[model samples]
Target: MELKKILCAVDLMDTVNPAVEYAKMLADMSGASVSVIYVISSRSTYENLQVPVEEIAKGMRRIWSRSREDMDAFVAAYFPGVDATGFIYEGKPAEKIVEIAREQDVDMIVMGTHAREGLDRLFFGSVANEVVKSSKCPVMTIRPEKKSE
Candidate 1:
């Protein structure tokens, strides 16, 4: 397939390099541009909280600023010398990931999965699973290698 753009979804909470490496490899082979998206899942929680408007605004700003920094750092570390766009969105992570993939009209979506099964999957709610089901483009999920304890 002729790939012009790739969407890389990162949680910034787990091991993010592995998935990014796959995306970068694909992009290198297909000459595609990469867009990294980090979705903030705490927006709804903040909105539902009984907090002052000013406090909520401050909280939101803090989250946005920190997310931006993290996203930039991730891109720089994983995609050095590559032109990658980093984006931050607020809302449900799975929903945002699918939405951005559609909006960007990406050729492929790459992400990392915890590979949770059974009760763990149900309790954690796999973002990779949701994106795979919801995205129109091809989805590639990478499960990080287990760290040696």
Candidate 2:
């Protein structure tokens, strides 16, 4: 398919190189722009508390800050010709990814998923599953290689 823009949604747990490489290759092949989205979905433990929100927000900022820096450096050095933009969003990951894909008019979306089965999948919802079901455009799910192997 002819892709003008591609949306890549990644989290802290996602492997940086493979996903980025796949995105770059797609962008190059399709002459599309790649936009990387990272969402900070940290939730407050206490529903009603006087705890400082900035405490969590600050940590999120730092996490994203370092992540983005690494992402930028990688993109610039490796994907020289691809136009790359990174975004930070807050809220539920699956919903935010769908929102961004629609908002940005991305033609295709690529994401990575850690094996979520049984209680893990039940307790924590699957972002890739949700996005594939709800997205207007096509979704690509990448399974990372096992670190133990």
Please give the lDDT score for candidate 1: 0.84
User: Mind giving the per-residue lDDT tens digits that candidate 1 earns over 1-149?
Assistant: 89899999887766534588898888888888999998887656776778887898898898889888988898988898666899998888898899999988899999988766789779978888999998899999888786212
- Global lDDT of each candidate: 0.84, 0.77
Candidate 2: list runs displaced more than 4 Å: 16-18, 42-54, 147-149
Residue range 1-149, candidate 2, lDDT tens digits: 68999998876444443466778889988889998887777455322356677776666678778877866765577568788887777777888899999999999998877666788789977878998999999998877765211
Q: Estimate each model's TM-score.
A: 0.88, 0.79
What TM-score, to 2 decimals, does candidate 1 have? 0.88
Best by TM-score: 1
> In angstroms, how far off is 88's CA in candidate 1?
0.7
